[model samples]
Target: MSMSGDPVLERVRAIEDDFADAMSRMYTVGNELATLRARLETEASPAQWTPVAEPAAPPTPAAATAAPQPSPVPTAPAGLVTPPPPAHAPAYAPAAVPPPARPLPPAEPWWQRDGVVAKILAVVGATITLIGVAFLLALAIQMGFFGPVARVTSGALLAMGLVGAAALVRRREAGTVGALGLAATGIATAYLDVLAVTRIYDWVPLAGGMVIAGLIALGGVLLARAWDSQLLAVVAVLGVALMAPFVGLDHARLTGAFLLVLTIATWPAQVGRRWWALELARVVPTGLFLAALALAQERTAVPVVLALGLAVLVVGTTVAGTRSERLPLQLGALVPVGVMPVWSAGVAAPDRWVGTALLVVATCLLLLAAGLVVHREGTAPQHRVPEIALAAAGVTSLTAAPRAVDGGSLAIVAIVGVALVWAVAALVLRQRSVLLVAWGLGVIALLGSLALLPYVVLRSQAGDVGPRHLVTAVLLVALLVVTARASDRIIPATAPVLSRALLALAVVSTGGAVVVSGVLLGQLLDDPRGGFTAGQAGATVVWMAAAALLLLRGLRGSTIAVPAGLTLAAASVVKLLLFDLAFLGGLARVVSFIVAGLLLLGMGAGYAQALERSRREGTDRTPPGPPPGPVDNPTAPTPIPPTV
Candidate 1:
C-alpha cells in the first residue's frame, strides 16, 4: 500500500514501522535488564566469600622498592609505562555497571503494624470499662450506699472526668489507644447517664434526655474527626444505639425519633470517608427499632414517618456524596428506599388508596434512579454503576408492586402496565438496563398470573369480575404481543435464545386468549357446560389457524418459524384427537373434528405444492446443460489432428 508513491501515506507507514521497531527494542532492553540484575546478584554473592585458593598477598613498602617494575609494552613510548590494574579487580573483561538496587523497608508482623493491636485493645478496654462501671453502680445501689442524687451526681462527675482524661491523654499521645478507649467510655457513660436521667429517675423528660444524648454523641463524632479515627466514629454512633432501649424502652415514637436524629447527626461523618461500618451502625438500630414497633402492633405511623425521613436522608446523602466508582455505598444506601414500599404495604391496611400510594412511591423511586443515571452519565461519563443501581431499585420496587396492590389481579394488571411501559422505553431508548427491567417486569407479571389469571377469567364468567378483570386480560395480552413482536429490536443481538422464548410465549398467550374469549362468550349466553366444550373445540381450530400462518411465514424463508409452526400443528392434532374428542358433543364436536381435518389436509397440500413450485423455480433459474463430450479447443494446433 505504501508502495503506491503517495508521500503522506508513505511517511505514515514509515512512522508505523519505526514504532514497531521501537517497541521491539523496548522489550529486548527490559529482558536484558532483568538478566543483568540476576547475574549481578549471583556474582556479588560469590565475591563476598573468600576464594578456596587465595591469591598471593600484595607487596609491602620495602618489598615494592626491592621488586623490579614490569617493563612497558614494546609498541609503547619509553616514558609512557602502562599502569597496572588494581589487585582487587577481576581478571575477566569489564562489563557495564548495574544500577543501584532500591532499598526495601524492613517487614513487620501484621498485629504489630498499623496500630492493629492498639485498636483491638482499645475496643476491649472500652467494653470492659462500661461493664465494670455498670456492675459497681449496681452493687452500690443494691448495698444502699448512695441515694438517687448521689448516684446521678457521681455518674456525671465520672463522665466529665473520663472526657477530661481523654483530652489530656490525646494531648500527650495523639491517636493512641488510651485516648480512644477513654473517649469511647466517656461518650457511652454520658449516654447512659442521660438514659438514667430519663428512665430511672424521670428527672429530665425523654425529649430533653435524647437531645442531651445526641449532643454527647455529636461531640464524640467531632473528636473522632479531629483524631482521624474511624473506630472512634463508629463507637460514637454505636453509643447512641446501645442506649436507645434504656431511654425509650416503652416509647416507640420517642425511640424512633431518637434513632432518626442520630442517623441525621452521623450523616456528616460519612462525608469524605466512605465509612460503611459507621453507616451500618446507624442503619441497623433504626431497622431493629422499626422491626420492634411493627412486631408490637403499635401505631407505626410516627415511627414510619421518621424512618422514611432517615431513608431519604441516607439515600440523598449517599447519591450526592459519592461518584460512580463508589456504587456499593450508593446501592447499599438504596436498601431502605427499596424496602419502604414493601414495609408500607405489609403494615398498612389493605385499601385501594393505600395500594395506589405505594405504587406511586415505587414509581417515584424508579424515576429517581433514572434521573441519577442520566445525571451521573452526563456529568462524569463513567461505567455502568448508575445503571446497576437503577436495575436494583427497579427489581425491588417492582417486586413490591404485587404486595402493594389490593388484590392479586389488580397487581398483575399494574405490573403488566409497568412492563409495557418499560418495554416501550427500551424500544425507544435502547438501553440495556431498560431492556432488562422490561424483561424482569414481564417475568414478574407472569409469576403473578400463575394463580390469579385463571381465577380472573373464572370470576368474570361467574359475573363477579369488574373492569379490573377485563383490563388485566387486555393489558396482559397486549404486553405479551408487544414484547414478542419487538423482542428482536429490544433484546440485545447476543440473546437470540431469549428472543425465541418470548416468541414462544406470545404464541401460547395468543392461543389461550382466543380460547378463553370463546368460553367467555358462551358463558355470557348462559351456557357453562356447553361453553367449556365449545371453547376447547374452538381452541383446536385457532391453534390450527395459527400453525398455518406460521407455516406461511416459514415459506418466506424463516428457519425458526418452520419448527414453531410444525410444533404448533402437532399440538393442534393432539388437542383435537384427545381433548375435543373426549369433551365436545353435538354440532360442536362434529364441526371441530371436520374443520381441523380439512385445515390439516389443506396445509399438507399447500406445503407439497410449495416444495414443488420452489423446485420448479430453481430448475428454471438454470438452463439444461449440453451433454458432456470431447471438444476441439479454439487454440489447439494442427498437430492435434496428426496425433489423432
Candidate 2:
C-alpha cells in the first residue's frame, strides 16, 4: 500500500511493476541478441575463394584412347592405391590412377542391417544359456561337489564380468553390451551379498543384515554413476528391496526396514534426479507410505501421534521446498501428508474411523477456506472446492455419526450443527447458489432431529401428546417456515424470483400445517370418532375464520397472509363438500352451514369496509374529468402535468 493503505492502487501498482519488468526483460533480450549478432559478424570466419578454373577442354579422342589402358590396378587398400595424377599432368596421366577405390561399401549399421536380428537372437540365446549354466553350477554346489568353492566361483564370475565391462568401455563400443555386463555383475554380486548378509544375520543382528543390503545398494549407485546408466541403478535398488524381506526378520521388522530403505532411496529422486531414476523413485515414496500405513494399522499401538507430527513435517517441508524451488518434491510431499492423518485416525480408532476421518476432512476443508481467504494471493481462483468439501464432509459426518455414536439425540444435534455451519458459510462466503441448498439441507436435518427425537430417542414417552411432542413439531414447522420467510435475507437481492419462491413455500408450508393440525385437533378433542363427524364441520368453520383473520392481517400489510387465508378458505370448502356432507349427522350438517355462512358474511363485510376506507382516504379515488363523452372539451382544456 506504500503506507497509504489503498489496496486497489496497490494491486494496480503491482501489475504495473510486473508489466515494466517484462518490458525491460524483453528490451534486454533484444539488446543482447543485437550485440551477439554484431559480434558474430565481426568474428565470422572468412569465406574461402578459389580461382575459377577454365573448363578443361575435353581430352581429345586419341589421348583418351592413348591414356594407358587404365589397367584395372589390382584393387589395393587405400595406402597402396595409385595416387591421382597432378592437374597439370592430368591430361596424360588420367589412366595412371586407379579409379578411386570403389567407394567403400557404405558401412551398414548393425541395427538396420540384415544381421541385427541375428545379434539380438545371439544375445537372447547367450542370456538363456548363461542362466542354464548358472543353475547347473548351483545344483552342483548343492550336491556338495563344489561346496567349498561356491563363493570363490561366484567371485570369479563377478571379477570376469567387471573386466569385460572395463574392456568394452575402453573400446568405446560398449553401447548395449557394457550395460548388460554391468547389470549381470551386479546380479552375481547380489547373491554373494545375500549370502554375506545371511552370515551377518546369524551372528550380529538385524542391523547387520541391513548394512549388508545397504552396501549392495551403494554398489549399484556407484556403478550407475560410473557407467552413466540409470537402468543399472534402478535394478540395484530394486534388488535390495526384493531381497530385504527374505533376510528372516519378523513381519513387522521387515515391513519397517523395507519402508526405511525405500524412503532413503526416494530422496535422490525428490531432490532433482534425472529421467529414469525420477520416474522409478516417484513410486517409491508412495509405496513406502502405504505400506507403512498398513503396518501401522496392524500394530496394537500405532504411532498416531507420531504420524501427526510427521504430517506437520510433511507440510512444512513442502512449503520450504516451494520456497526453495524444489517443485517436484513439493508436489510429492502432499500425498503422504494428506494420507497420514486419515490413516492415523483410522488406525487410532478403527471402530469409529469413518467419523474420525470425516471430522478430519471437515477440519481440513475449513482450513482450506481460511487459507483461501487469508493467503496473500487473495482468492485468485475463487474456488468452490472448500465449499464442496465442506458439504461432503458434513454429509459424511452425519451418515457416520449414527453408527459411531451411542446417543441418537447427540447425533441429531451434530447433524443440525453441520447443516447450520454450511448455511452460515454459504452466506458469509457470498455463495448464493449455496444459500438455498444450505437452507434445504438444514431444514431436512432439523426435521430429522425433531422427528426422530420423540420416536427413536424418546420412544419411552411416545404415546403422550404432551409438550415435548408439541414443542418438537413447532420447532420443525417453524424452521421450514422461517427458511422460506426469511429467504430474502438469506438469498441475495439479485435473485428476487428465488426469494419469492421461498416465500411462497413458507406460505404453503405454514398454512398447510395450520389447517391439518387444526382439523386433527378439532376431531381429536370433540368427536374422537376417528373419522368425519360434526367436529369435522366445526373444523371447517375454524379454517374459514382463520382465513378471515389472515385477510384482516393482509389488509394491515402482511402480503403472505392474503394467500394463506385464501388457501385456508379453499381447503375448508373442499372439506365441507367432500368429507363433512358425507359423514356428519343432520345437526352437525346444519351447524356447519350456519357457521360457514356467518364466516362468509363477515369476510364480505370486512372486504367492503376496507375498500370504502381506501376510497375515503383518497388512495383509491380518481381525479374528476369531463366524462369520456367530452373528448373535445378535454382538448380545449389545459395540458396535463407530466407527473400525472
Candidate 3:
C-alpha cells in the first residue's frame, strides 16, 4: 500500500503488475485461437469465403445535411482530467440503409453426415434390417407359400432387384446393401440347390446348381466393379458357399478342381481393390481341392495339388512381403512346403522317393532364401519362420519316405542320417536352441531306425553278429557323448524333459529289437543259445544301469527315472522268457523279482541324490551371507576364508 514512497520499489511493483496483465491476456488469446483451430479442422469441409464485390462507397448525402449541431461540454470526475477527442473526427451524419444478408447452402443428406455416431447407428440399422429380410425369405421358402419353382424364381428375382436398387443408391450406402443382399442370395441358393441335389436328380443336379451360382457370383462381381462397392467380398463368400455342397458330395474331387480353377481365373480381376476377399477366395477353393483329392483315394493328384499349393503360396508370400512385411504371411507361404511331405507320403513307391527328394531340395532352397531375406533386412521377423518351416519339412520328409517307398532296412537308416545332418547344419549355422534340440532328437531317431530296421529285414537269416546289439551299444554311447558335450549349452534345470523323451525313444527301440530278435531269429537257431543269448540279459541290465547313473550325475534336474528304471527292469522280462522256454520257471520268477527290486532302489537313490544336490547348491549360493557368526560380541571379528 505504501510502495509509492520508495521509487525503486514502486517501479518494480508497476513492472510486475504490467507483466502479469500481459501474460493473462496472452494466455486468453492463445486458448481462444486453439479452440477455433480445432473446431475448424474437425469440419469435413471447413468454410472460407471470397468477397463477391467490393463494398460500395457509402451513399453521399443529397447535396447538404441539416445544420450542424454544437459539441457538448466535456465533464471529468473529481480527481481526473478529461482528454480531448481527436481532431480527425468525422463531420457527417450516419447512413440510413442496411446491408443485405447472405444466403446459407442446402443441408447435406442424413447418410452423408460427418457425425460418426449417427453413421454407426445407420450401419447397424441396415445390418439388422438385412438379417430380418433374410430370415423372412428363408421362412417363406420353407413354408411353401408358392410352388417350389415359383419360390426359387421369386427369390432370385427379388435378390436381383435389390442388388439393382443398391447400385443406384448413394455409394456409401450401396456397399452395405449390396453385400447383405448378395450374401443372403448365396446362402438361399446353396441351401435350395443342395436339398434338390440330394433329394431329386441325385448327383447331376449339382452341376446345374454350381453353374447358376457361378453366374450369379460373376454378376455380383461385375456389379461391384461397376458401382464401386465391396460386393466382390460378398461374391467370394457366395463362391465358398456354392463349393460347400460339393464338399460333402461323392464328386468332391471334380467339384473342387472346377471351383479352384474358377477362383484362380477370377483372382486377377480382383487384384488391388478387395485383397482380403481375394485371399479368402483363393484359400477356400484350394482347401476344398486338397480335401477332395484326399477323400477320393487317388494318389495321382498328390503332386498336382502340392504344386498348385506352392504356386499360390509363392504368389501370396510375394504380395505379403512387398505390401505388408508381416511374419504370418511368410510363415503361411512355408505351410505348403510343410504339407508337401504329407502329400508325398501318399504317392506310389517310385513317385514317393522322387517326391521326398524334391521336398528335401525344396526345403534347402527355402532355407537359403530365408537366410538371404534375414541378411538383407535384419528388422523383419518373417525370415525366421521360413527357416523353421524348412527344418520341419526335412524332418517330415525323412520320416515319411521309408514307409511310402516300402524300401529295405538300409533306406530307413539313410533317411535318419539325412535328417541328422540337416538338423546339425541348421544348429551350427543358426545357434538356435530349438534347432539344436531338434538335431539331438534327430540323432535319437536315427539310432532307433538303425537298431530296429536291419533285424526286421533279415528275418530268420540274422547271423551271430546281427546289427541290433551293435546299434544299441553305439546309440547308448552316442547319447551319452552328445548329452555330456551339450550340457553347458542346455540349461540343466530344463534338461530333464528332453532327456526323458530321449530315454523313451531308447526304451521303445531297444524293446522293439528284443521282440524282433525273438520273433524272427530265435526260431531259426537250432541251439537257441548261440549269439547275443538271453544270458546277456543281465549284462544289458547293467549297461542300462550305467547309462541311468551317468544321466543322474550329468543331469542335475528332474529325473526321468521311470524310463531309466524300466529299461533295467526289462532285463528280468528277458530272463523270464528264456527260463520259461527252457523249463526253469520258478527260478526265473525269483531272479526277475530280485533284479527288478535292485533296479528300482538304484534309480530312486540316484534321483534323490541329484535332487538333494540341486537344493543344496541353490541354498548355499543365495545372498545375505551365511546366517550369522556364533559370537554375540558385535565388535569381535570372526575370521574364515571363503572356499569354492
Candidate 4:
C-alpha cells in the first residue's frame, strides 16, 4: 500500500475512465449513423452514398502476414464482440469519428411564414381603419359638417369607395385587408347616400344621392366581372335595392326602364339547367312594374303605354317560356285579353246605341282572338273562351236590336226566330256556362215576346194596357223559364226535384197568366161588346186543361216537359180568362179566385215535394242540366257532331 502499490488503483481508475469515454464516443457515432440513415430513407436516393477513404498507415509485417484478419470489428454490428487479449495487444484504446453537421430545415413558404401573420394583421388593421374613416365621414355628412359641400364630399367618397372596391376585386393578390376595406367603404358610402336621398325626399330617392350609389354598385358589378370576383353579385344586388325606391316615383320611370333593361341583359346569368325559376323571378318583376305604371296613370299616353306594356308582357312571357320550357308562361300570355275588356269598358260611351254597337264589335273581335289563341295553344275544354265570347256577342247583339219596329208594333216573330236558333245551338255546344246562360235568356226573351205581343197589340188597340203590362208579363214568364231550366240542368240526376220544379214553374206561369188575363177580361166585360163568347170560354178552359196535363207529365220526368208545360200553361191562362168573360158573367170573380188558389196550392206542394226529394237524392233541386245537349237531359251521351 506504499507509492508502488497506490499506482495499481490509479491505473484501475484510468482504465475505467477510458472505457467510459470509448462508450460515449461509440454512442455518438451510432446516433450520427442512425440520423444519416433516416435522412437517406426520407430522401431515398443514391446521392447519400460516398466512397470510403484509404487508411494513412501501411500494414506492418505482422498485420500483413496475419491471416487476412477478420474484417475490422465494427462497433455495435449485429451482435456484441469482446476486446482482444492484453497479452497480444498493448492495451485497449478508444477511437472516435467526428460528428456530422445537421442540415438546416427547409425555409417555410411565404403564406406559412411569420411575415404572413404580420401581413394579415396589417390588412385587418387597415380594414378597420378604413371602416372607421367611412363611419366618421357619414357622421360628418349627417351633421352637416360641410353643408352643401357634404353632398359633393359624399359623392366623392362613394366614387372612391366604388373604385377601391373595384381595384380590390381586380387585384386578387390584395389579401383580406384590401377586400374588406374595399367592401366596407363601398357599402358604407352607398348606405349614406341612400340615407341622404331618402331624407331629402319622403319616399323615392332614386333621383339624387341614391342614383350615384346605384351607379357605384353597377360599377362594382362590372369591375367584379372584369376581375373574376364574386363581389359583383353582391354589389349588383345592392344596386337593385338602391334603385327600388325610384320605382315609386313618377319620374322613376326612367330608372325602372333602366332596371328592366338591366334585368334583361343579366338574364343570361340565370341561364342554366336549373335556373329557370330564378330567371322567371328576375324578368317578371320588370313586366309587372311596367304594367302597374300603365294602370296608374290617366293621361292620353295611357293607351300607348298600356300597349307597350302588353307587348313587353308578351315578349317577357315568350322569353320565359323559352328559358324555362314551361306552360304557365304560355297560359299567362292570355291575361292581356282581360285587359282589353277593361280598356273597352273605360272607353265605352254612355249612349246605349253607341255603346251597344261598340261592345258588340269588341266582343266579336275578342271572340275571334280567343278562338285563335285556343286553337294555337291546343287547349281543350278550358279553352272555350271563344265559344263563350261568341255566345255573349250573340246575346248582346240581340239585346241591342230594336224591340219594336218603326210602326210601333213588336217584332215578336223575328226575335223569337233568332232566340230559338241561338238556344238550340247553345244547347248543342255547351262548353261555356256564360254562353249557355246567355242563349237560354235569349230564348226566354223570345218566348216572352211571343206570348205578350198579342196582348200588347190588343191593349194598344183598346188604349188600355200600357208598356207596364207587357213588361210584367215578360218578366214573370222569363223568370219561370230561367229558374226551371237552371234547376233542371244543375240537378240533372235528381229526377224528382227537376220534375217537380218543372211542374211548379208550369203551374205558376199558367196560373199567373190566367189571373192577369182574367183581370183583362173583367175590364173588357165592363163594356158589353168586349165580353168573350161562350165558345171562346170553352176553348180557354180546354187550353188551361191541356197546360195542366203538360205540367203533370213534366213532373213524370219527361225531358220536353218544361217547355211544353209552359206553352200549354200560357195558352190555358189565355183561354181561362176568355171563358170567364164569356160564360162565367158575374161568377168570373169567384171562378178566378178559386182557380188562382188551386194553382198556388198546386205549385207550392210540388215545389216542396221536389225539394224534399232532392234532399233525399243528395242533389241540389236548382236546375242545371248536362253541359252540352238539349235544354233537357238527353237519355244517351251523344257524340259531338262535327261542325259544318
- How accurate locally, in lDDT, is each candidate? 0.67, 0.51, 0.49, 0.48
Writing each residue's lDDT as its tens digit, candidate 3 over 207-318 gives: 6656655565566566556645454455544554555545436655556555655555455444445344445555545554554454345556543565445444543554
Local error of candidate 1 at residue 68 (angstroms): 49
Over 1-644, each residue of candidate 1 has an lDDT whose tens digit, in order, gives 45568888657655554544444344344444544655676586543332222122222334333433343111222222222445532322234456679999889889978778888888898889989999999999999998899888989999889888988898885457788889888888887788788898999988888888888888888988888877788888888887876678877678877887787777777655656677778777776676455435444466546645654665565555454444334434444543453344444534556545644554455456455643443443332345655575566556556655654557777777778777777777767677777778888877765643453234234334345544665666677666665667755564567666766676666555555565566668877556556666776888889898888888878888878889999998987887677767899999999999999999999988997888889888856798779977698565565543
Regions of model 2 farther than 4 Å from truth: 1-204, 211-254, 257-265, 273-302, 321-329, 332-338, 341-409, 430-644
Higher TM-score: candidate 2 or 3?
A: 3
Candidate with top TM-score is 1
Q: Higher TM-score: candidate 1 or 2?
A: 1
TM-score of each: 0.72, 0.44, 0.46, 0.36
After superposition, the stretches of candidate 4 with alpha carbons farther than 4 Å from their true spots are 1-140, 145-301, 304-426, 432-546, 551-644
Write the candidate numbers in order of decreasing lDDT: 1, 2, 3, 4
lDDT of 4 by residue, 566-622 (tens): 676665566455645444555544655466447646754775687477567766455
TM for candidate 4 is 0.36
Which candidate should be chosen as best, given lDDT against the real structure? 1
Model 2, 273-311: lDDT tens digits are 444353344344434444465445554433343344434
Q: On TM-score, who's better, 3 or 4?
A: 3
